[model samples]
Target: MSDIVGELARVAGAFDQPTLTLLYRGHAKVVIAMLRSAFTRDNRTISAARLHAQVDTYLDQLRIDGFTDLPSGSGRDLCLRWMRGQWLVRSVADDGAEVYTLTSHAQDALNLVTNLTRERASLSEHRIATIVNAVRRFNTEVNPDRGARVDILNSEIARLTRERDRLLQGADLTRPSADYMLEGYGELLQLVAALPSDFARVQEAFTALRTQILGSFRAEDRHAGEVIDDYLRRTDSLMTATAEGRAFEGAFTLLRDDELLLQLREDLSALLSHPMAEDILNDVDRRDLRGTVGLIRRGIDAVLAQRNRVTATLREYIQTHNTVRDRELDNTLRQLDAELARWMTSAGPRTTVALPLLPARLDVHHLRERFHNPDDDAGPPPLRDVTTQRPDGLTLADLLAQGGPSLDQLRAAVHEALASDEPLASLGRLFDALDAPLRRPVEIFGLLHLTTNMDDFVRDKEHTEVYRTLRPDGTRRDLAVPVITPGPQSPDSPVTFAEEPRGRAPRLEPA
Candidate 1:
């Protein structure tokens, strides 16, 4: 009776889990389909806006298909609801984009749906063989007796050697039957599909650990060093302590071993190329099989990124945490709480207290004000006329030289050079040939700027050309500029300079 009651309680607890709750909810099929479509093994995360749009589209399609019983609200609202339900996690990516990722519970739910939908024999020769091989290998590795372990290894080696020799000797190859291949493929996919959730579990564990560490810090009961030490110890043990962590470690080890990875790839390729593979797997299945290594790599990256985030959190807290200020704030809050309690005890329920949020303003008998006297308000005397004074004789050319680059003049030069019958080789050559005014140092910037708005200019990064710029004072300076070559320009969009307001420089607008 006790055992039966315990089993019932365990069953109840399992049903209470988020994974089961997701499955038990209304419109589970639609929700699951949406999630599976939105997030995949390769594409684990979707930007919040993109995902919301996708959800809305999916819901629209479902409604069009005559599915009336659906979740109420917009996609964003649904996402928020799902987040609260723990199916979707809203987090900021490293690039600071808000993204939604399926929680491990949601992944488990998806995996369960995938498995249930997939067709495979419940009992198969491949399944039995896999189990037997696993058991044999487990026993061989864990056997306490050295002689027994050696004997087991020797027998396995002998068996493999005989098989290898037979294959090498041109013996007829034993081809896997389609059913056997199908079963194996099914098993492999199931294993592969579980990896995402496993990785998510590890990430969630780290996230939870980080949250706990933060709480401990906020509590201020433990010393920073002790908290750090405890964190270090937990992080060290994490990879070995949990099933997800162990799986992640195994995947990490596999990733680090280049030879092993190469071998795995070769084996997957060989399997994929098998004659039975064509019938056993579809395009999706084949693609998934081919991307096994990539999937593992992505999983490892996500786990490492999560771990790095935790490390960053620890480092940031240690660097920025102000013990003195935090203590002061904590004491202040305690004093406020004590005073509030005393007031509550003495006051009636209906009594009201009016208090100023800020300190009262200072009181003064008099604020000295300056009254406007007639003398003070009197206007200044009339200014002297400067019309009689003669100004220095300056030419328009001199004013142009002292002012900004001659963009309009530079544009005409570039247009004439480009429109010439002879091929205009480069901008530098054109600048060198230009008149003194157009060859000003500032005019070089104007030339480059004009070329940028043109259609056919290509700047050669590898080489540079010198622009011999002439100053107004007759001083010349050669500036090294990137080699800009103009390509064949389109007749329709000719580069033209347009006039602007008086003070503004003319721009090279495309015609």
Candidate 2:
């Protein structure tokens, strides 16, 4: 068994490293000796020719399987083939030729076999002993028939009860509708957003009060009343504000004069005024100091309950969505990673060959024709784009200006470096640091687009005005104002806005 394991290891190693090819070839002689020794107990002499024939037959059989073909000259293959060639009766060579003798190589093989075989047998015995001990202990201690049937029947009954309930509920049961609950959640969110720098401060204070209430049920927590009062006062002040300080009758608004959330509050107020609950709602004052507190508290509780249910539903939805999305993304990423790994392992593309362009040089005006619809319906077939860049005609400065070097170009550079005896590892490291293929900048402006934004200027205190140089000579400057035109529009098109700009100079070009 040890001998077989060693042979399997030697064969597996051959595919892992090219350098180990010749080393395993020398291990054959000992294997053949071990085989001969195993068969030597038979009282018969094995002829060399017959022995060689037997080994050849074994080798033929191995070839039929997936094992690599062994060379006739390889000592290891010779020994293995000879061992398999033997008929039922075993025999040995003496002169290490046909005298049923073992060679020094065969002795070494036997030593390895002895150690491994002993280790394997010891492990097997230990495993069997452990299994037997466990079985005996369990059998002695456990009464398999003791109340098991009752317990099993109870478990089955419970399982069946649950399954029946599930069937009655229907496997495709949907959630309670979002129509009645969304307004409450939205109001809570809006209320949180309307607070000063420490948004949700009142909510946090109330949460602490609730925690304290739970901890000391009977104790007079006077601080809880103070906390709730402070929160109520702040919420009341926010709900009554209006344009030009005119007294308002709503909670809040995101738009002019009337807040959209105030409408939601009114709608909910109406919904809660049903025939069953009208008496409770009617007693509460619409703008009374204490009445607002009760309304806010009730709203907060309703929103909290709705949130808990929605959050659980959202979690289930997200978990199912992510499972499918993650599987697809993982498969795609693996394929991309494999392609990239392969490129790293093998010889990369050569880019020295000059890429000839079409008769007309590509420009922005011709971009649509060159890239999108390059030919008419009956026109000649479009020219296929080539991977190689024109390197010979262009100067180094021009090449550097044209987005540095491509992967193909860099690969060509590596080939050149190799011929000059430069380090390939260092070259590889430089390429590895580069951004991935699609993320790499394909245009000059794309590289520049990443560097600046209006927000950057706004955030910088030093700059009074932000402007862009129109020419390399720096003769002219254009006031940098972001403009978005309504409807489908282009950069060159006139800009328009639904409302007039507030308080700022007309820096943007007029529509």
Candidate 3:
């Protein structure tokens, strides 16, 4: 009786697991359908806002379909409720977007419903063969007696060699029936479907481990080094100690082996192309089979990403952890808690006490140093009478000589030269004909600038032009500039120049 009771209790405990509870709930079908639709092998996560809107749309459609026994509230509220139920997990993704992912329990529930809904043979030659082959392989690897293991391997090799010889001899190939193909495809898909939940388990394990480590860090109950050592040890054992970890390690090995991966792809392609495949499998089945390798790769990437996050968390904590400050804060919090407990014991529910939100200000009487003084603020002694001081006077021509180029005069000279029937051979000839003021060194720059903007000018790279510039002190200096030749202007858009300044040169500087 006790043994039966113990077995019953074990079964009950299994049913109580979140994975089972999810299926046992009132809206199990609706929830499972939603999860399967939202999360797929290729897409494992959805941004929070997108998922909320999707859920709302799903609920709205369900209501329109007359399924009124549905959960109330908006999609966001439903998601939060699902999160509390451990069916949906809300986490910040690597890109810092808040995303929703199906928890391992939720994935398991979905997988179960999928298996149940899909039509599959309960028993088949393919299924039996798979079991037998698995058992034979397991025995060959694990058999304690070396002689037995070697004998098993030899037998397998001999059988395969005989089959290969027969195939090479042009023996007629035996084709599998549609039913057999269907059964095999079903088994393959079932295995493929389970991979997501398996990967999710490993990811959840790492996340839980990280959460525990963070708690330990906050508590400071153990030395940081000891905690880190424990973390490293667990992490190293993680890939070997648990079933999911072992599966991940196997998948990781498969990923590393290029030849094996290629062979897998070839085999899947061959299976998909079989004559029976068309009748046995549908488009969805074909897609799932074709994407098996991609699914495994994604799963491995997700697990590795989760592991990296844990490592980063540990590293960041180690780099920023301040033992002295943490200890001081811990002590202060403990003292505060003790005082609060004592006060609570002596106080009634209605009793109240006035307390300032911040610490009281210091009652300072005086400060010796002053930031400002009235004596220093006195106006400066009446401005010095600089009117009595005589300064040298300057004329407008002196200022213009010291200023920039006379652009108007230079522009008119170039336009006149280009517009004339006998245009100047080079800008140097025009410069020589210009008035003294327009031949200033600065005016040479102005002519070059205007020439660059006109279509009627071409620079002669082989030659140089010298301009005689008159200095403010009445001295002449020859300056060499690049030679520019004026060409004929098109009649359609003739070059127009501003009239030369008629009055004295204008002062360019402020007084």
Best by TM-score: 1
Give the C-alpha miss distance for residue 6 in model 2, angstroms: 29
| Residue runs of model 2 more than 4 Å from their true location after superposition | 1-40, 43-45, 73-100, 118-511
Put the candidates in lDDT order, highest first. Answer: 1, 3, 2
Q: How accurate is candidate 3 locally (lDDT)?
A: 0.81
Winning model by lDDT: 1
Clashes of each: 0, 12, 0
Off by over 4 Å in 1: 235-243, 333-353, 358-511
Give me the displacement of residue 390 in model 3, in angstroms. Answer: 71
Displacement of residue 279 (Cα, Å) in model 2 is 88
lDDT of 2 by residue, 433-500 (tens): 43343122232122122212211111222222222322322344333334211122243543222222
lDDT of each: 0.85, 0.39, 0.81
lDDT tens readout by residue for model 3, 378-431: 988887788657556866887888899888777777777776787478877888
Can you write out model 1's per-residue Cα lDDT over 357-402, one digit (the tens) per residue?
9999999999879876899878999999997785678778788888
Error of 2 at 362 (Å): 99
- Which candidate model has the greater TM-score, 1 or 2? 1
